[model samples]
Target: MFHGLIPADRYYAYLSFRDIESMPNKENVIIIQTVGAVEQHGPHLPLMTDAAIGLYIVGKTLEQLDHDKSPTIYVLPPQYSGYSVEHTSFCGTISLSASTLTNVLMDIGDSVYRAGFRKLLFFNSHGGQPQVTEIVARDLRKRHSDLMLFSIFAWDLPNIAATLVTPHEFKYGIHAGEIETSLMLVILKEYVKMNLAEKEYPPTLVPDGGLLRIDAGLTYAWMTKDLSQSGVIGDPTEATSDKGEQILASLIASFKKLLLEIDAFNSHV
Candidate 1:
């Protein structure tokens, strides 16, 4: 029951102590920890939006893999709360401090390493905490040189945004906008308040020949309040379940490929 969408045998917590001890090739086990956030995703989407998306992606990807032929992969329980200081002004956001998140992830990695696993991957869905995961991954690697640590942002793996959204939405819809809303529509349709969805974008100050931007090559420190009053930074009005489905398919395909590659990867260093 605790396994949720993940296969019962592949859910890390489902394994008994003896079961884990008996597992063969423990060094090759790919332990994925889905990192998400409990934060504001505008009035239209739930606070669990980020967490739900990450879990769904990981769960679906695992489902599609051939257990016997694919690399040994198991998923830890999802980390539902993450660093979300940028959305703290909103009512639903529950943010962990950068240090707190870092320590939590480090502890998880340490436990996994202690349990005889050599590989750990942080599959994060929130836009606010990649830095924290990256820092934790590097620090953990420094501590355990033999541990294989990997981190990835879920949305960064797919290139379907341009096909599903407008050019303007593609660039500014970095938050609870079209991209996320569409995904939510498919992931948690009943929870989505489509009627309440609104289009909003932050002011982009492209000064001195586009030298400055919000989410571009050169960015600034900005909170949701600074750019948008609606707690949204993208056009959710354009989101549709069709687009969400397409996006999910692309993401799953890419994720499956990545997992296989990680299985075969060996560092020369």
Candidate 2:
């Protein structure tokens, strides 16, 4: 581990209730709960793709922080099964209904709130579940007016990829594409079977509407099966370890800066 203070599991799973009590600071506690899903991501990527990536992001954020300042954030064991209805027809997807997901989060919030934590930040990686997590955050606020809750789904750190990676494949590569494959290459290399990584060319524009996927302002819902047969979109063949490293580094830098501000923010509402 880069930092010696690394927890046993890089999550709350390793800590006992007494451990939280003895912590030096509790006044501005923020539980950064990562939300992900176990679902099919093409043939090359593992079912835990989103969850594993979430863990990497969180771990890197903590690794680079200035612990001497006493950051008040703790990572909870991730909610590994989220809304994955689009991929449920596939063998690997485990999904929760919108209501069930919200209530499950509410249960987590109630327990953590009762334990005296004042804030909950949902760091969601699964794209299908941000709306659900957003509802959960609002539900917590409805019950506890004093709590601070934030829900976030994606990051634009890859905007820097244009200069780093030639013929950047991120825009077309939405699902188990180059960005994710590159990330898996860096974080879980052994698991990524590159020989099996096939390119999935998504329609750059919708068939009837001719709406450009990358250049248009669009928000249409469709199942994963409706798109790629292999459960993939974008070009995984373009992925490289260097690109992944650059992306992760930028992510850590951006997230760490925001984390510092969040640790001290006092909710007005």
Candidate 3:
């Protein structure tokens, strides 16, 4: 039941040990692990917003692929906990320490590598844990030179936020804002509470021209409490299910293309 989002045939956890050992083109098979976080996403969204997005994207992408013609791609179980030290002050936020997360990912990568699978992709949906995944990927690469490991954020891959959202939202909606709320509408509509949606942004000390900002070339350490009273950084009121559909489609298409590329990739070249 947990694998309902993914096609049963392509769900990695459903296979037996022997099935894995005997899988064709083991080196070329891409094992995707969806990385997400359980953290406060304001009052309008569920704590599993990031996790839901990651799972839905991966599932939809795989569903669109032609298994007979496409590279062998299997979806691993979602990593639901991630580094969210910044949001720990808020209730419903469950964060893993940087070192603990690093170790957990390293162990997962090691297990995947040991299973004779040479390709692994850490498809993360949370903003706080990209660096952790990247570090684990590099460390695993060093340990196993032949393994092809990739770490990427779901939104960063396509970079569709700029085109779909307003300039202010694109810059400030890093948490449970317009983009995330819109996406959640598509991925987990029942959990979203549109009535409670509100717009809030962190207090900015300097003008837009100044270097100091929440996210930019120059930034400072900040917690959610320091930013907004509602634990929101963007305008969720701007979210619409129509916008969510568009974002979902774009993300699925981009992820499907990326998987094919990774399957045929030759790192040495």
lDDT by candidate, in order shown: 0.89, 0.77, 0.88
Better of 2 and 3 by lDDT: 3
TM-score-superior candidate, 1 or 2: 1
| Candidate 1, pairs of clashing residues | none
| Top candidate, metric lDDT | 1
Off by over 4 Å in 1: none
Question: Candidate 2: what lDDT?
Answer: 0.77
lDDT of residue 112 for candidate 1: 97
Clashing pairs in 3: none
TM-score of 3: 0.96
1-269 per-residue lDDT for model 1 (tens digits):
98887788789998899989989999889999999999999889999999999898899998998877988898998899999999989997899999999999999999999999999999999888888999999999999989999999987896586887888788788888998999998999999998999988877555545777787567878888998889988999888899999999999999999999899876645
Error of 3 at 143 (Å): 0.5
Q: How good is model 2 by TM-score?
A: 0.88
Off by over 4 Å in 2: 1-6, 22-24, 156-159, 162-168, 204-217
Candidate 3, which segments miss by more than 4 Å at Cα? none
- Give the range where candidate 2 is weakest over 10 consecutive residues by summed lDDT: 1-10
lDDT tens digits by residue: candidate 2, 1-269:
42223354446656788877786656587688888889999999999889888778777778776666757677876788888998976787888888888888899988888878887888888877778988889989999987888887745333365555445354556788888888889989999988889987655446545554442256577777777788887788778899889887877777776677788789783
